[model samples]
Target: MKKKRPSLQDVANQVGVTKMTISRYLRDTSQVSTALRSKIAIALDKLGYIPNRAPEILSNATSKAIGVLLPSLTNQVFAEVLRGIESVTDSHGYQTMLAHYGYSSEREEFRLASLLSYNIDGLILSERLHTERTLKMIEVAGIPVVEIMDSSSPCIDLAVGFNNHDAAYQITKEILKSGHSKPVYLGARHDERTIIRLQGYEQAMREFGLEPRNICTDRPSSYSLGCELLKEALRRYPDTDSIFCTNDDIAIGAAFECQRQKLRIPNDMAIAGFHGHDIGQSMEPKLTSVLTPREEIGKVAAQRLLARLRGETVTPKILDLGFTLLYGDSI
Candidate 1:
């Protein structure tokens, strides 16, 4: 009922070469003469032969593939990070497999299991907070792991990210120095990073002897949610002079809401956000944000994994890439 796939021997016979010669040619073209190489290539094309990699995989135990786990695809920040990863992986002749878990540790565990079943060489994870089962599974896999985006939690193997708490603290202090004491924190998702950023904001407010207000949501960060949070913040704390959002999405949303309310930037209400997302700068009153090195984190994480795979030593398991605060029209 189905057509059989052509084998290596079939192509070898058609090319008038021994099976071993065909095998050597397939592995390395440089091993064969130019005329023989051309003949083998022609035979492969004529017979529609596909080289079976199962035997090589059985001997090497490597799929020549790396697994990357992401939280949400909607977040535009990962685009740059993925680009950096591909820049390294492609050059090294390794492929990447991506999986998303919507920021859930349980879903992440399942995805990790699936990736492991394929015998991936290494893994790149976005979150540091993993379930106990996930941790055990990663330990058993015995593959190189690199965690990115949050450096607050203890890492499994290697960590490449910035200190989210310190970044938030520095930005919040800057807002305070700009003469906006009545500051409120706006956040969403309430993930690990969200909590850390909140802690930084709270610490800054407490150090300055200013009472902090937090208006947050359990939903994922979005422009719409930002507007709702800002609306609620204004209603509860009518004198809310400054608002620090968890990410750029919420900050942009808050900026739009401020415009609808006819509020002047920094004078009536100052808005600042985390992550130097492009839309932040495109705004009429450009958003002030904490710029995390997202792309460098991805690039460095891939490099470390590749080094481990190549049997090279990777020093300093933990890496803090650092962050920058970009001041703009919106304080």
Candidate 2:
């Protein structure tokens, strides 16, 4: 279990005063004796009681805690983004509460409802489940909601995501530039992000007057799936020279399959991935990938929510966190 955070009651007991006086001091209420204020302030420092400064709009509730609802924490993409979100939130003395719904819409709704029961000031929704009911609930909740990871929809007050089409097109173009006429698209079927990446690959290939047969999306990538898919894709397109996985995990699997078959990384078959997972950098032949601005996106989303909570009427509905190409040994 975690250590208990000292509360105002603790400070009240230690300062030898009623909770009313402590509340007055926290709110900077006048009509308190100077000597008593000093004693209470000292006790506050000694007991380490942090005053929760939430937006005043709630009127009945206040909190410095924000809730994050994502698909899963096992994925390193979420971990890196959380790192960025925490970097800013910790400095501002706010705490983050994480909840994994594993792509279930019902679970997401439940999580959102549960967070409302607490005194949370804001929420970061990484997935885009823009149902009318969800929107209605958010409207009644009287809090800020920021969308992350996907940029296709602006159903919320704020959003943060990169141009999926551009990122994929650039990576695919790199594959073609390296003398690979037919490159394979390796990944799962995502929502709009996946569709954009698919379009990007098709668009790049079509620009070169090539057919759009150079693509294959799959279930979440694993060594087994990578090995199995690589065998079939290579057999079908024997002249294929490169493979671009949607995320780093899939790319890593493809790289491993090439190793098992004694294929040189870029020399034999170029490989790349998205999400820029940390494991890619440490692989035997480092995997080339695109580094999404996970941290910046999280930080920006938080800032937008804060702005909304402060009653700002700014239209920051769309935020583009650009991508960075990581040219590792594989490329």
Q: Pick the candidate with the highest TM-score.
A: 1
- Residue 153 displacement (Å), model 1: 2.3
Which regions of candidate 2 deviate over 4 angstroms? 1-11, 24-59, 189-191, 213-218, 221-225
User: Model 2, 1-331: lDDT tens per residue?
Assistant: 9888897788889988888889888877465789898898799889888775544425665577888888767767787778878887787767888888766677788777787767688889877765566667788977788888866655567778888888888988888887877788765645456667888888988887776654455355565666666777788888877887777877787788898999898988888889787889889788888889887888887777777777887475787778888888786
Off by over 4 Å in 1: 1-26, 35-52, 58-60
> Candidate 1's residue-wise lDDT over 94-166, tens digit each?
8899999998889999999998877789999998889999999899989999999877679999988899999
**Cα distance off (Å), candidate 1, residue 232:** 1.8
Each prediction's whole-model lDDT (CA): 0.90, 0.77
Kindly report which residue pairs in candidate 2 clash with one another: none
Candidate 2 residue 148 Cα shift, in angstroms, is: 1.4
